[model samples]
Target chain A: EAGVTQSPTHLIKTRGQQATLRCSPISGHTSVYWYQQALGLGLQFLLWYDEGEERNRGNFPPRFSGRQFPNYSSELNVNALELEDSALYLCASNDLGDYGYTFGSGTRLTVV
Target chain B: AQSVTQPDIHITVSEGASLELRCNYSYGATPYLFWYVQSPGQGLQLLLKYFSGDTLVQGIKGFEAEFKRSQSSFNLRKPSVHWSDAAEYFCAVGARSRGYQKVTFGIGTKLQVIP
Candidate 1:
């Protein structure tokens, strides 16, 4: 079966602009997670969605928000993007209550 | 909350040599431990995990990890290294929150294999 899928492997946006990244979880998965991997900074959790509900989020600001679709697909939105937001954004999926997640290749967002 | 620490930022080992990556975790209770490997421009792949039962767990690609409860550590080990094994390794700790798994990752350790 195909793993978690992400669209537009690379994206470029101007500072203060908005960016939207999409993800399709593996079939039968119910939970979607978003993470930001910045240079020098490790993976930082952005958001978690389960059953189309926002379950939890990390220490990120309100500008970083996302929603999960009915079909378990997810969209991550970064508003008012800044140069520091240039990093690899990854999406992962897993079954509810599962211990591990399957991650996508990620979208590299460059804010100039 | 839970956290993970991979003390080593990078390591180099020759092919055919044994390899070990250190990992430490802090949690109130027993946690779900994991080892993930990511190649350049690729997503993370599960190398192994330890939830319960035997402390020693075997995973794909000749990888294995031992969970030490006393030390609160789960270290990844490979008997023989391969050139393809060169990548960044992340150690994570998972805890149950609101019936879902919440995971935290370490800074990651970059592995370099030499011939």
Candidate 2:
């Protein structure tokens, strides 16, 4: 089975600009999660969407927001990007009630 | 709030040598545990997980982790290290309550293999 898929392997944006990253969950998966991995840092949770609802979010600012679509695909939007916003944004999916997650390769966002 | 700790920032091991990476967690209740590996420029990959029952859990790529409730620890181990095993590893904890589960990940440990 195909694992989670993300678009735009790499993205470059300037400070104060906005960026959008997309993810497509694995087939039959209902939960999509977003994570950010800054350079030399671990994955930091961003948001969680299940059944078309925003279930939870991390400590990130409101500028980091996203939503899940009816088809279970997801989009992460980062507004007012700063140099610190540069990171690899990952997307993961899992079946409802399942603990394991399959992650996407991630979009490498570079904010200048 | 739940948190995971991976004390080792980096570790070096020779090929064919046994390897162990430590992890500890702080949670109010029993937490689902997991280990994930990420090669450079790649996404994280699940190595193994422990929900309950057996303390020892085997995972892909010949990796395994042992959960110790007394220590509140889950350490990943490989009987024989391979050069390909060099990657960043993360330990995570998931709280299963309130009709949902929220996961928290560690800072990660980077493994270096010397051939």
Which of the numbered candidates is closest to the native, going by highest TM-score?
1
Pairs that clash in candidate 1: none
Residue pairs of candidate 2 with colliding backbone atoms: none
Write down the lDDT of every candidate, Cα atoms only: 0.96, 0.93
lDDT (Cα, tens digit) per residue for candidate 1, span A26-110? 9999999999999989999999999999999999999999999999999999999999999999999999857888999999999
TM-score of 1: 0.98
* CAPRI tier of model 2: medium
Error of 1 at A109 (Å): 0.4
TM-score of every candidate's chain A: 0.98, 0.97
After superposition, the stretches of candidate 1 with alpha carbons farther than 4 Å from their true spots are: none
For candidate 1, lDDT tens digit of each residue in B1-115?
A: 8999999999999999999999999999989999999999989999999999999999999999999999999999999999999999999999998677899999999999999
For candidate 2, the clash count comes to 0
